[model samples]
Target: MSTATPAHSSAQSGTAAIQSATIETRDWLIAAAAAIVALIALYAVFMDNGSLISATGDYLHEFAHDGRHLFGAPCH
Candidate 1:
């Protein structure tokens, strides 16, 4: 009185596997950290005006300034 096939069992198992899949906390933490780093890099490249790295002298400022000009960002 059983009509279950091998293909039907495999399909059920695949659905179960998909339903069991979960995004762990570590994955979320890594994503958050990456976003933070990207934000910091963007800030350093575009918005930094010696206020962020003032103690390091104008080296970083000039570097970012030149980078801006290279990208045609109009810094002056």
Candidate 2:
């Protein structure tokens, strides 16, 4: 919540725009939080210098990131 809001308040603005924005924010927050958690878990898994499974997960995540970057989305 910003201290300075736009001129269009809930009363003046329609409900649809507000609802959509709220939903989008919720989705973005969820995605961001999940990504962060994934990173932290990955770090923890590799903390002991990693077992085979941990190393495999790290490689898989790197591969997934590379693929996403190449295609511009999770699977293009």
Candidate 3:
């Protein structure tokens, strides 16, 4: 009185596992990229002394001046 079928094979399960791994890897890559970008932005705001964005003149420096002071970054 069994109603089991052989349609769901090991190959299909393997493919599904691979797809799940790929999605997890993609999510990790995205998170890593976002963290790197955030670190760069923090450097520009707190540690950069016009070297990171020298092409943009003093715009970034002036914009983040108060923030730098607030965070004790020694902008002076």
Candidate 4:
């Protein structure tokens, strides 16, 4: 009879792979949550029209930033 460790087909291999996948998925979820929170905070800060208008000028400043072609002169 052969005498080998018989580790070529071990259950631990599949378990390790599953654990690695779970860890990777958790990392992605955390990163996504952080990004979403950051976006929300930014939106709250910029959504105040009065503040934005006072900071710059004109309430339409935010929209104009998207494209300068609409305005008569190029944006600074």
Candidate 5:
């Protein structure tokens, strides 16, 4: 007698099984560090107002003036 299995017993194609993903502490730390750096850059670009990096006259101000208007942050 033949011992072949039925066609319905085969695995499905194209679709993958679900998985449970977890974030470790190191991953969170890296993400937080990147976020902090991005925030500092954003501050320098939009809300600097020549307070933190404006020691050399209006260089920073002038440099980011067009950017301020483009972002609608109001530098005037």
Candidate 6:
């Protein structure tokens, strides 16, 4: 025998709890910008070979070198 229950139970028998949240257009834009920045950073960390930000010299390469090797990317 088994009993079934909703994941979230409320004081009201038939109604699930509702939590109200709002995100403005500005907030969405900011979040999108942040996501893009994060993706760019990830690409720089993993796929960049001193071309995207070559002004930084080999700093980025050396910084993420161990990470590349750890992820089994052939740096040689």
Best by TM-score: 3
Best by lDDT: 3
- Cα lDDT tens digits, model 1, 1-76, are 1566877888998987776664455677899999999998887787677777669565566788878888766575
Mind giving the per-residue lDDT tens digits that candidate 3 earns over 22-64? Answer: 9999999999999999999888888877788669677788899
lDDT (10s digit) by residue, model 4, range 1-76: 1334446445677788999999999999999999999886554344434453466554454564444445333444
lDDT of 5: 0.69
Alpha-carbon RMSD, candidate 3: 2.8
In order, candidate lDDTs are 0.76, 0.61, 0.85, 0.60, 0.69, 0.72
lDDT of 6 by residue, 1-76 (tens): 1233443343443342222123355678899999999999988887788788769877787899999889876674
> Which pairs, if any, clash in model 1?
none
Ranked candidates (TM-score, high to low)? 3, 5, 6, 1, 4, 2
State model 6's lDDT: 0.72
Each model's TM-score? 0.57, 0.43, 0.78, 0.50, 0.60, 0.59
Ranking by lDDT: 3, 1, 6, 5, 2, 4
Flag regions of model 1 displaced more than 4 Å: 1-23
* Ten-residue region with minimum lDDT total, candidate 6: 13-22
What are the per-model C-alpha RMSD values against the true structure? Answer: 4.9, 12.3, 2.8, 7.1, 7.6, 9.9
lDDT of 2 by residue, 1-76 (tens): 4644564465457677788899999999999999999887754433322333654755554545655456554332
Worst ten-residue run, lDDT, model 3? 1-10
For model 2, the run of ten residues with the poorest summed lDDT: 43-52
User: Could you give candidate 5's per-residue lDDT for residues 1-76 as a string of tens digits?
Assistant: 1344433333322122211123355678899999999998887787786776547456666799998999898788
Model 2 TM-score, all chains together: 0.43
